[model samples]
Target: MQKNSQEKDEKLLEKRFAELSRTAFQRDIITYTDFLNLNEQNILHTLPKDTLYTRVVSFGGYELAERQMAAFIPDALYLRWGKSSDPLDYTEYPFSAVRIAPLNRKFAEELTHRDYLGAILNLGIERCKTGDILTDREGAVVFLHRDMAGLVMDELTRVRHTSVKAELLSAGLIDYSPEYEEVRGTVASVRLDTLLALGFSSSRSRLTGLIEGGKVYVNGRLITSNGYQPEEGDVISVRGMGKFRYQETGGKTRKNRISVVLRRYV
Candidate 1:
């Protein structure tokens, strides 16, 4: 049931991709899509290599963003500089930041990513229409499409009883790094299940179910093997769990086990 629905969604996405590229080529202009997750991006990457319609690129309104928008570039726009090698030089992504600041710092609650997203969804806005929501000490910065920035700014006033003020920031100006807590543990090996168990402090037996159930992704690519090993600096995302970064920072322990570190998202 769910598998069939997912297949249908992927097919629909492929069709949408072709249509956007066709429109961009026919009109000789750029066509864009709302924000896409890593799985959706993988679908786009699986499309045919040679496309006559347009070239595709993506940006999430700022650096170090996970959710992003895709732009289909026609030849006229892609080759404006005459055979330029860099895609970033030719394209201007249609995304901007909305700085959601608290009305009163003293009274503001410690907001979270879920809180901001919940407030945004409460505005009747679809999740696909928005990019990543970066949250921190002062407030959150939602990567919103240019079309609905005004609505978010005007209506998204209160998050969990804390009044917030929104301001539109210039695109491509904000720098973001996700917050994480350093966790160190000794694993028997750097296998996928072992690393995940270390990160979540779960038994490998249960973690194996997650890996085999298509719930684990390393650097945005799905991994299904319990024995699959992850490299250093690999970002792992577990559906319904949390994100983790794997790092092998030390040599073998005194017990001859591997010393590993996992940066768990806080």
Candidate 2:
């Protein structure tokens, strides 16, 4: 019975693959997040172990040409590029067309040094050093490796910037809203060591030991003082354990105990 069921499932998968292959594939723009989600759900499962995936980023006229190639040879590679119509929507679906941010108009007009790197940097975008590079008519371009693209996109979302549009583009899958609330109370007013004594740490002495051992970082910088008073907006990253941000200092209790909220970041 189990063998029959396994055979039936395999047949169904093959049928689905055949159906997908018969469809008219077209190039379209898709967000990096969307692309990754699709990969996790559809592409990865279907891809064979020996399958080879090629990613190309082009800046110029051959956009149509690339799409044509992808449609005919769907099983050979995956293509990602910016949407020509909307421009802003960087679509990565359908395995044919994917679009990222385009070159700036001013930069395109000058055309002195045509490269995707300049435009990516101008947009304040950073790609992993090990990513790919592709050039078309547009300029310098950054191509992320298939495996690492998602991670790079996630890291880019953490950067705060003045341009709302740019920020939106970079925030691929991250929620921008303030999700965690502030825990209020005087517990927040106490020093790091004191707070740890009140059950924040395994033991008060352990907290001090961590501090003296130089195993803590506040807001990306190392902090050594056990007496250091953390406030709202302060992020404490401890070695071995995860990090948390101090949210607020609540009013004092009748027993002089304080309340506080800490946002944990893994």
Candidate 3:
């Protein structure tokens, strides 16, 4: 049943991709998609190049964004601009970034990514309109569909018990890298399950269910195999858990186990 549902979703996504390409090609303007998660972005990445009538570009307002918006650029635009113009440097990017911070840092609770996401979703905003939320104890930056930013800023007054402020910023030009804590551990191998267990500090037996349940993704591709080896520098996302990056894979112990280093995003 889950597989069938996924197929239906994929078909719908493929149709959207085709429509966006056709709209851009026929109308001679850029067409954009709502924010898409890693799995959905993977679907976009898998589309055959030959099938697309226009060039596709993706950005989520920052460098390390996990959720992104895709823009379809028509050939007519390229022709009009001449060979010297680059479409990526176009005048407008189709997303907005809002920085949310507490009124009083000393008294505020250290809110998390989940807290921000939950607060936004509770306001009746659809998940597709939101993107990567970079959160720290100081505050968070949330990417949203350009049209929805105003509503969020006006309606979002508090997060947890703290009174907050939300202000939209001039995005796309800004880049952000989230802070993380270094995690060092030893594993028998660089297998997906082993890496996840080490990064999350959880047992492989417990995490296997998450892998098999299709809730884990590595570099935007769904990974189900426990034995799948993630190369160094891979970014992994576990649904409902969080995201982390494999920083180093070296330092073999006397027992022949690999000492791995990971950056677990805070």
Candidate 4:
């Protein structure tokens, strides 16, 4: 039964790939991914050359990730496909950042990533039409399709209970830097459970549950094996826990445990 379902899903994914290629070949503008999961990304990578999209398709986010976030996570990725040789062409990419600020400091509610996301989603914009929503102490910055920039700038007046004003930030002036914290830890093994437990400061038992529950993805593939040994440069993402890059091992400790370095997206 599972194999049959897998075959059905693969067929659907193949159709999606064809649709994406057709859209790119027909439309001159760029397009984004429609919330691809880790399995789907692996399928995309392994697709036959003849079945693949011919144009340049670039993937990026505010932060780097192997199993990319569809929209809301810290390492959310935005896929852009266009005819230009330069992927950084702001004109062809047509991405705009909107700075949403609260009216009053004292009465203002502390906005979260979800708060900003929910507000933008409330505007009837599809998730793929937008990118990351970065929130700070004062306000939030939302990256979205340029076509919807005007609508967001005009109609986005309130975020939840907080009255806010949205202003369009110059495309050239927008910064896409990601914040992350370096972590050094020791693990008994390089297994998925060990590294994840060390990186998240959680128990191996807990991480095991997550891995078995299919909430862990590594290098753009859903990894269900807790004993799966991850290689250096592999990005591990735990749903609700955040994403991290597994750097090289720093040699084994006296106790035979491996010392590892990780960069957790903050």
Best-fitting candidate, measured by TM-score? 1
Question: What Cα-based lDDT does every candidate model obtain?
Answer: 0.84, 0.40, 0.86, 0.72
Residue 90 miss distance in model 4 (angstroms): 9.1
Residue 175 in candidate 1, Cα distance off native in Å: 1.4
RMSD versus native structure for model 1 = 3.1
lDDT of 2 by residue, 146-193 (tens): 444444343332112211111122323322222333333345356766
lDDT of 4 by residue, 1-266 (tens): 99899899898977777676656555543454554555666666667767744442434334452322221101111224233324454223545678899988789988888988898899999876676677788798777777888999999999889999999887666565667798998988889999998889889998899999878888767789988999999889887788888988999989998899998888
* Alpha-carbon RMSD of each model: 3.1, 20.0, 3.4, 6.0
Better of 1 and 4 by TM-score: 1
Query: Which 10 consecutive positions of candidate 2 have the poorest summed lDDT?
Result: 64-73
CA lDDT for candidate 2: 0.40
Off by over 4 Å in 2: 1-171, 176-189, 196-201
Model 4, TM vs. native:
0.76
Candidate 3 ranges beyond 4 A from true positions: 1-3, 48-51, 74-91, 104-110
TM-score of each: 0.84, 0.34, 0.82, 0.76
Stretch of 10 with least lDDT, candidate 1: 81-90
- Report the C-alpha lDDT of model 1 over 40-66, residue by residue, as the tens digit: 876787687763378887777654467
Candidate 4: residue 82 Cα off by (Å): 14
lDDT of 1: 0.84
